[model samples]
Target: MKLHTIVGVALAVLVATAGVAAATPGANAQDSNSDDAAKQGPPSELPDPVPEFVSSIHDAVSDFLDGALDGSLGDAVNDVTGSSQSPPTSADR
Candidate 1:
C-alpha cells in the first residue's frame, strides 16, 4: 500500500510538470512584432529582371553607337554647318 501511494504521487507530479510545460509559450509564439508585420500588409514584390536586363543592354548599345558616330563625324558636321566653336589654340594666339 505504501509503495502504491509513492508511485501514485510520482505519477501525479510528472503529469503536473508536463501540463505546466505544455501551457507555457515557446520561442515562436505570437508577439508584438508579428502583430505589427500583419498590420503592415504583404511585402513588396521584386521587379522582373528580363525587361530590366534588356533595357540595360539597349542603353549600352545605343551609347556605344552614339559615341562611335560622334567621334567619326562630329567635326565634319560642325565644319559643314559653320558652327565650329573650337577654342583658341597657341597658333591662333
Candidate 2:
C-alpha cells in the first residue's frame, strides 16, 4: 500500500511539472512580444532617477562635511593654538 501511494504521488508531481514546463514557453512568448512592442517606443534619456538623486544627496553631504571640516574645525584648531591666522579659503588652495 505504501509503495502504491508513493508511486501515485510521484506520478502526480511529474504531471504537474510537465504541465508547467509546457505552459511556460507560451507565457514567455507572450512576454517577449510585449517586450518587443515596448522596445519600439521612444527611448528615454534617463529611465531611472535613483542614481541622479543619490548623487545629489552625496554632493549635499560632501558639501556639509567640507564646510564642517574647513570652517568650524579650522577655527577650533586655531583657537586652541592661539593663532590669529584665518581658515584657508578655496582660493588659497
Which one wins on lDDT?
Answer: 2
Clashing pairs in 2: none
Candidate 2: residue 41 lDDT (0-100): 55
Task: Looking at model 1, report the run of 10 residues with the lowest lDDT sum.
Answer: 69-78
TM per prediction: 0.33, 0.28
lDDT of 1 by residue, 1-93 (tens): 699999999999999999999999999776766766576656599765674445544554565577744443434444444556764557988
In candidate 1 the C-alpha lDDT for residue 31 amounts to: 75
Off by over 4 Å in 1: 35-93
Candidate with top TM-score is 1
lDDT of 2 by residue, 1-93 (tens): 699999999999999999988877663364545767677657667565564445544554565577744446556555555679998889999
